[model samples]
Target: MFTPRTPRIVAARRLQRRRDRDQTGRFLAEGPQAVREALAADAVLELFATPAAIERYPDLAAQAPELSPVTDDALAALAETVQPQGLVAICEQNDVSIGEALAKEPRLVAVVAEIRDPGNAGTVLRTADAAGAGAVIFAGDAVDPYNGKCVRSSAGSLFHVDVVRSPLSVVDLLQDNGLQVLATSGTGEDDVDSLLDGGHLAPRTAWLFGSEAHGLPADLLSSADRRVRVPIYGGAESLNLAAAAAVCLYASARAQR
Candidate 1:
């Protein structure tokens, strides 16, 4: 059994940092679900699991490119959660270029910009995938999708949707690809329901979302073809980032289909 002090386990523990992940062009995926999805995507390079985990998830072990039996302490060292799931996989980063993603001509896309929270970012990615969005772009200074929390929160959706991480003119690019860019905002000219009723949401659309605190940058908001706000029926101030994203993406999904 590999101990925490083992050379391979020590190296794997370093993946907890963004710098290390970036340098190595790989990230860690924890839990059986993540490991399974990573395996399905052919992204896992190696899997480290406790004996119990190997026995519990025999299919995952059989599918892994390489499997290493690890002590519980070793698994803990590589896991971000307090309770390690006994399975972790070192997988390659799967982000593609913005141009490459747009080439698919996705009818619905989510462009997340300057989102700092990994959990929210991941949840949005998962929501986008669930809404049948073809791609998700992490633009500007958004949190890394490969962050441990982000990967975990994605719940395996990270391997389903086309992910793009790039510093580019996102609005212009989407417009060039025949996708109308829509920005989500608290105070906006168009109401989401009105747009849907008017048959405006059925076209190829890319939703631009920013951080909850700062919202979208001024230039991006202005560049978007339409600024849309979700109606709140209750007394709540506003929906959180993930909730708002779900509302917007699902609206587009409903209209497109």
Candidate 2:
């Protein structure tokens, strides 16, 4: 079993930090489900697990010829969570460009702009994948997609969907590709349900969502092909970024079907 001081273990532990991940172009996938998905995506470069974890998921271990067994303390050191799940994999980055993602003619896409919360960002990624979105784009000043919290929150869906990070021109890029970029707002001109039922959620569509703290910027809202709002029948003030994304993405998914 590998000790905490092992060179490989030490290197993998460095991946928990954003700077190290950015420099190495690799990130850590924690837990059995995430590791399994990363392996399926062919993104895992190396697998590290505790002896118990390797024993519990022998099939997972079999898939990784480079599996290394480590002590429980070593596993915890590699994990970002309070309670480590005992399994972690060092994975190569998988982010693509906007043009590359659009080349495949995605029917539904989720465009996240300036979102800071890693958990929310990851949940959005997971939701987009579940809703059959062809891509999930992190635009503007968004959180790092490879952030450990983001990867963990995405469960296994990070591997299931194409993820992109655009510095600034995401809207322009989507529009140039003939996609209808629809921004969401609390007081949008069109109702989300109405658009869905009317079959107006365009075939080649991208749903634009803003950050958790603030909704979309005014210029962005005005620039969209259309501004849509999810109607609130109940007394809730508003939905959070993740919840709104799930609703909008699923709506587009059902419409496309």
Candidate 3:
């Protein structure tokens, strides 16, 4: 028997459904590594690429023969960019309660807010994964965590951690759980290094990273109990949102250990 061909365009309206990951709380996982990790994690592998791209990663095809494969044009259409790495897998987004994130189980978390750049947001997620953060929260109008660049930049790390998007009020709830909310700012009282180097940090801490241009909004900055900065030891006046997140996350990681 033959299967129906995946579309060359794949319908933009259809792709929008993935933004929420509401059905199963899991979103689309794409590219070779991302798809591979999703399948490995038992995430729903809803789609695959044509044999041309499939041939590039024989191992994935072998592992997930059940994929609904489609052509390169189809793959590119489904993907968010021109450089289609030959794979796309949609899965449940995995919804976890905000309290679950601040339980101090992992002892560290990264909170992102108003990050406009998908690449930066994705990069932050990758850093959170590397730093062993328990979760990453995309608060405010941050870029979609499921953006194609983010899914790619994560390098499969996105699969490893719990990612949630919400408002500052939700962040306040995390604070009530004994999770310190440290907002990043150029005008912060002390550098994040000092906060980390002060030789003391709570078992559960949240790093509220801001946007590239505006940093955190005024209200959010005011809402955070503590304000911290990742000081520039060099000529640079500031750090990229992603890079700053990595530093703070790792700092918390080091502190917890």
Candidate 4:
């Protein structure tokens, strides 16, 4: 069993940092679900599991191209969670270029711009996949999609959807691809339901979502084809980023399908 101080274990632990992940072109995916998804995507480079985890998930171990039996202490050293799930896979960073993603002629897409919270970003990614979005673009200063919290929060959807990390102008890219760009804002001129009712959501669409603290920038909002708001019938002031994204993406999904 590999110990915490083992050379390979030490190297794997470094992946917890963004700099290391970027430099190595790899990231860590923890828990059985994430490991299974990474394996299915052919993104896993190496897998580390505790003896008990291997026994409990023999099928996962059997499928690994490379597996390392790690001591519980070593797993703890490598994991970011309070209770490590006993399995972690070192996987390749699979983000594609914005042009490449748009080349597929996706009907529905989500553009995450400067969203710093990993949980919110991950939830949006998972929601996009559930709503049948063809791609998700992490633009501007958005959080790393490979963040452990983001990966865990995505619940395996990260592997299922096309991911794009680009600093290019997303509005222009989507517009160039014949996708109508819609930005969500409290003071927006159009309502989501109104667009759906008018059959405007049937076309290829890309929903632009901004940071949790601040909504989309003025330039992006202006660049969007339409600024839309999700009508809230309740006393709630506003919906969080992930909730708002779900409402908007599903509206488009319903209209397009």
Candidate 5:
């Protein structure tokens, strides 16, 4: 059994930080679901799990004979949570550039700008995947898609969709790809449902969701082909990033279908 101080465990632990992840071009996928997804994607470079977890997933363990059995303490140390699921996999980063993802001629896309919350970021990716979006792009100062929390929150959907991280103007990139860029704002002029009813939701569209704290930047909002809002009938202030994104993406997906 591997100890907490094992060289591989040490390296895996270092990946908990963004700087180390970037330097090594690797990230940790915790839990059976994430590990299975990473393995299916052929992205898992190494795996660390407790014997119990290994026995629980004997078929998966058989698929990946490189699984390393570790003590529960060692497994907990590799995981980000207080009580880990006794499984973690070291995976190579799956980052794709804006230009590269755009090359696929995606009909629907989700663009995130400066969203700092890793959970929100992962939720958007999961929503986008469920909506059958062609891709999800993290633009400007957005959080890293490979963040441990982000990966965990995605629930393995990260591997199901194409993801791009770019500092370039997302609006320009989508527009250049012959897609209509729709920005979501709380005080926007157009309502999301209205756009859907009006058939203004383009078949080839990219929905832009901004940081929940600041919303979309003025320049970015203005750059969008159009700005739309989710009609809030309730007294609540507004929808958060994930809620707003799910509504917008589903609307577009229904329209495009």
Candidate 6:
């Protein structure tokens, strides 16, 4: 077994389960993009990169002053993925509320409800960042935004976006702030395109999507101002939630532009 040079850091990584991370108010971001974004955003407390990964991304070393170049075994020891590479960073998680995020200078928001897939949630956040959304809201039963897998899947976009976690009250708060809380569902009168065509996409709208398997909770579904679906021509039952959210948010982006 390969031993860690920095025992304290290694011990912390070994102890960094989801609950431990939540309690400590810290999380790890894995991969080159994640580490770079964290450094660029000044969100990282510490950075750890391996020799090979550092060789591939020398700019990262130039960017973050407090980086540690360690062996691949050490980097792999801290990672949650099967193939951890490039870099990793420990950063403080944002404790801001969805209510606060809704109250900020954002016209577009992507609402993720009960989205169990880390890839879906991360992709939605990435899309929101690309769309210049004010915030990405993780409503009830959603996956943890700070999960290492989520951070990696986001492809560095997490650093540019405001991620919020909260209950359903923020939905009403969004409405009060001139936002239209539109949910995506199979049974809907108007499609997403119709809403966008009618110019409803610019009013600080919230594009709500659901989990892959269960969809949004029924109560939350009923609470939406509008239930809309994406029109499909292929034999697919539904577009992946991340793809759907991307389409919705980007459509809003194009409409606003």
Regions of candidate 6 where Cα sits further than 4 Å from its true position: 52-56
Residue 195 C-alpha lDDT in model 3:
75
Off by over 4 Å in 5: none
lDDT of each: 0.93, 0.88, 0.72, 0.93, 0.88, 0.78
TM-score pick, better of 2 and 5: 5
lDDT for residue 60 in candidate 4, whole number 0-100: 91
* Per-prediction TM-score: 0.98, 0.96, 0.85, 0.98, 0.97, 0.91
Q: What value does the lDDT take at residue 1 in candidate 2?
A: 85
Output the better candidate (4/5) by lDDT. Answer: 4
Clashing pairs in 4: none
Please give the TM-score that candidate 4 achieves against the real structure: 0.98
How does model 6 score by TM-score? 0.91
Candidate 6: worst-modelled 10 consecutive residues by lDDT = 1-10
Instruction: State the weakest 10-residue window (summed lDDT) of model 2.
Output: 77-86
What is the Å distance of residue 232 in model 1 from its true position? 2.0
lDDT for each residue of candidate 1 in 1-257, tens digit (9 for 90 to 100): 89999999999889889999989999999999999999999999999999999999899999999999999999998999876579999999998888889898999999899998999999999999999999999998999899999999999999999999977358999999999999999998998999999999999999999999999999999999999999989999899999999989989989988
List where candidate 2 sits over 4 angstroms from the true fold.
Answer: none
Which is the winner by TM-score between candidate 1 and candidate 3? 1
Q: Which digits, one per residue and each the tens of the lDDT, describe model 3 over residues 36-96?
A: 7877777754656677766788877777736666755566656665665777776656536
Native-to-model Cα distance after best TM-score fit, residue 233 in candidate 1, in Å: 2.3
Model 2: per-residue lDDT, tens digit, 1-257?
88889898998889878899989999999888999999999999889889888888999999985888899988888888766567899999998888899999888889888889999999999999999988999988889999999998999888988899887557777888888999999889998999988998757899999886788877778889899888998999888888888889988888878
**Per-residue CA lDDT of candidate 5, range 1-257, in tens?**
98899888887899999999999999999888898899899898888889998888886677664889999988988999875568888898987888888899998999888998999999999999999997999888888999989998888988988899888477877898899999999988999999999998856999899888899889889999888999999899998888999999999989988
Cα lDDT tens digits, model 4, 105-199, are 99999999999999999999999999999899999989999999999989999999899998837788789899999999988999999999999
| Model 4 poorest ten-residue lDDT run | 165-174
